[model samples]
Target: QITALDSDTNVHVYAASKWKTIELTSQMNVSTKTPYSNGIKFTWQQSYERGNQYCLAISAWRPFTSLCQARAADNYISGSTEATNHRRPAVVLMGCTDHHSYTLPERPHVIVHVAVWTRQGGPPLARAVVRPFKKPRVPRLQPGQLLTLEPSSGGRALARLRLRRGAKRLFVVAVACGANLKLQILSSDGSRVASVAGGQGALHLKLRQNQPSALKMVMTTNPPGAARTLLLAASTSAKGLPLPRLPRNTVVSTIKASCNNVTLQWKSASGNPNYCIMLQEDFNPGGHHIRALAQCDWEDVLQHPVGYLISQCNPGAMKARRQRYLVGHLLPAHAYIATILVQHPITRHVLALKPTYFKTKEDCSL
Candidate 1:
């Protein structure tokens, strides 16, 4: 008898006689081999883009069941690597005995084959189930926020999910092959709410609820592919909690050079909680000959003093403007310039001020 099995999709078929398996395998073109004692076994794994075809075949066995008696359904291996190729077919074979009586107690001879084919590029896919143990307090989706999927190696058509809370829209996007996005919506009861497919792979879903909305992303490949579901969490109420706090006004108030050490000070503005202070040596007022010297963050400051000091500006050399902050951190025996800057905390944009040059004691020497 002939039979067919889908190893990739976790589908199997078995018949008592050989002819049924041969007929089924012939139509499917499932590459299959038959063993007299063990029957037929099928196995496959791979994903193909549009306009690709895979084939399998098994036709040696005789007919026992009618050729058109096979049933088709969504194999459980949906949303899997084997399903990425889209539409596919599987075939197998079985052994038959002359007398339908007590048949020889031997393994049914059978062959199995499977193949995947596609027409247009497959659609973007996603997981089909999501379960959150802890509900969000006040779930809200924000723009530019990142969404991730767990166990994403199985050819699921989603990488990240972006949200436009005001628009009440969710963008389902692909990570690996993310192109040609479309929008889709589904009901809370896990039913086909709405779907759109096209050259785009993004989806914009309307919010069905006002409160904290929780739902899983259900994924479907083009065809002959698997389906999957993923959990989606749209609550970023406490996000951006760890963002770096920038400095406001970066002013060079004082620059003192004693031996090889240099101390620089600046003023802080409104929103900046911290500051980045860099001291450069070989400083040129407008030239690029200066190299970075001492660098530090406000958190590393010994105290919340109003001034910052950069020691060892030139290692052991005594230079004039040559030892200064890029904004002009320099001190000369008779001429020195200091530059100040003010930065925005959130924007990270820098506002600069002209450098103030001061003349040192005319009699000081290294």
Candidate 2:
């Protein structure tokens, strides 16, 4: 039994040849004030067992209830792992704050639950440590500087990087060797700015002064191996390289229109460039529509696009020198605007071409 919200429960079982069962319960009074002011860290380690492995489950919650059924709500955080020969340790980090707003309370209390079991009915031997520690200082990053991050024992690394002031655009490049990497960039207020997952890639970001003056970089590697390294670099100018010229005199025309689909054809550019087609809902396609779309970031356009496609075209090999794209799964009788864009093969920068406006047919199914 557990009565207190702020308490640690550890269960241990000795190794045995045959199946056995043991149970223990304890209760404590709830404390009004939490002792762990900074944060709490949970660590579990187990010895290797040849025939069987231990499965561990750990969770933390707040605002305790009397009924045991109320513990199912993991409002704070939870983690689980299976202890095997390759992976022998499991760790969980919890902060003393509300999950919705992430704000620290004047007095905080939390309940930590840990459970362990084995498949073969063999006794599992494990140890758990729960302690509170002060927050660690995060290192800062500067522009035009390269930072190398070594993989941690827990397979994640986090750091804070500052953006250059008065720059209209910023580019971030990341490369990982011998491992898969997932990188996420967040603003100061915890809002996501950009995220990329691959072995190597670059992210383009539009900047406003003092809006998101600082960014947090979260990098994680697969397998939790020790030999992985992530190289990160930021710059205002893309290594003194100029962006590719936007495609000129591009034309788009509608070939067929239906209640839920639209077929369009556009003439390819002279140089046979790689391009992307985007469809967006437009209630007002006026003089300022193209200007507004041009000002939006590429990531912003992807959020609410009705249809999108990317491909390369070779005008020299085609008879009509026109590419066809079918935009489907649209609402009936809805107005939409289609825009063409040419993208750089290496840097991933995109420039908008001409846009065409059209509307879907009315619903005929009665």
Candidate 3:
């Protein structure tokens, strides 16, 4: 099952069994001894230009009541990861089952299904492959210990660590260079505990534990075989650690509005050096717009923003003050919401500021 929270904090639950009927642009197969025996790797090369964006979805065939699927994009930047200007091909690795346990019933073979399409609505041009391999030995992680992995082209790595009893929280910090990084944490039963995607970022994971438990960490890089560096560290506490924080007093006020553009101004508190502004049409139910904005995060806002800009907060200046920005090429007389995001100078963590509401002017010439 998949559960998601919208901007209004509405809960959404999705069944895992419905993936069997979804149409796909492409599909492939892989063999495995048992449902939990080996890991399956999928690689695809994008035939389109690097600037174009595409969505990639992967799922395994399940004859029973449910299916396991994972989705990714070529240009996806998680809230925990810093946004980058470079683009890379999409790559992913999947185990036989979603559960962390190896006690599942055995299966002779597994079929893998892949779907690739452009964001603008057509089938994408790409080449893909599917293969199976033995699970590599994972290194045990000691408390507060940091580990680094450098994988060559078309390679993968794993690490194992035990979450001590009475420790109900886990924090993971990952830094990647030269390739897009994907991280997954799985329990001993093969069930996923938590996962995050980014080129570089940190994530906090919470799990209730009554006794000591073991976990497996999986890291993969995009472009299948691109050589990359991944620095991983795990701990239980966040006190005194340099992490991302939301900028305070981030409120946007409209300076000017035209038929197709809007000028906005907002003040930044001290220490906020960079900002990302996103504008999207307001299509939510009436009266819930502000509530939605108040509850949403960077990931939710970036999903379908119509206009986006990243700029220095106060370029060449050392003091905190107001900054002006313009979001152009919008529809006339359309209601929209603008959200501000602040990036930390050291951790590269991105957090959302309070969102502002506005509307474009009606076209006078009509």
What does candidate 3's lDDT look like per residue over 236-274, in tens digits? Answer: 764322333333455678877888888887776345446
lDDT top scorer = 3
Error of 3 at 196 (Å): 2.7
| lDDT for residue 345 in candidate 3, whole number 0-100 | 62
Query: Which run of 10 residues does model 1 get worst, by summed lDDT?
Result: 123-132
Superpose all Cα atoms of candidate 2 onto the true structure and report the RMSD in Å to 1 decimal: 19.8
Clashes of each: 59, 0, 9
Candidate 2, residues 1-98, lDDT tens digits: the string is 53545667666668755445434321212232434544333223322444454443343432222112222332323343322322222222222221
Question: Cα miss at 159, model 1 (Å)?
Answer: 14
Worst 10 residues of 3 by lDDT: 62-71
Candidate 2 CA-lDDT value = 0.51
**Candidate 3: residue pairs that collide:** 99-190, 99-191, 100-189, 100-190, 100-191, 101-189, 101-190, 153-225, 154-225
Candidate 1 C-alpha lDDT tens digits along 1-366: 545565534446775632112112212211124443323233332223333333222222222122231112122345667645534433232222122111112332332222222212122111111112232232223333333333223433322223334434333322112222233434445554456543312222333433224433444333212223222223323223122211223235556654333455544433332234433332343444222211113223323533443321112112222223333333444334443433334433332332343444433365
Kindly report which residue stretches of model 1 are placed more than 4 angstroms away from their true locations once superposed.
1-244, 247-267, 271-276, 282-366
lDDT of 2 at 24: 31
Which one wins by lDDT: 1 or 2?
A: 2
Which 10-residue span in candidate 2 carries the lowest summed lDDT? 95-104
The positional error of residue 76 in candidate 2, measured at the CA in angstroms, is 32
The total number of steric clashes, by the backbone 3 Å criterion, in model 1 comes to: 59
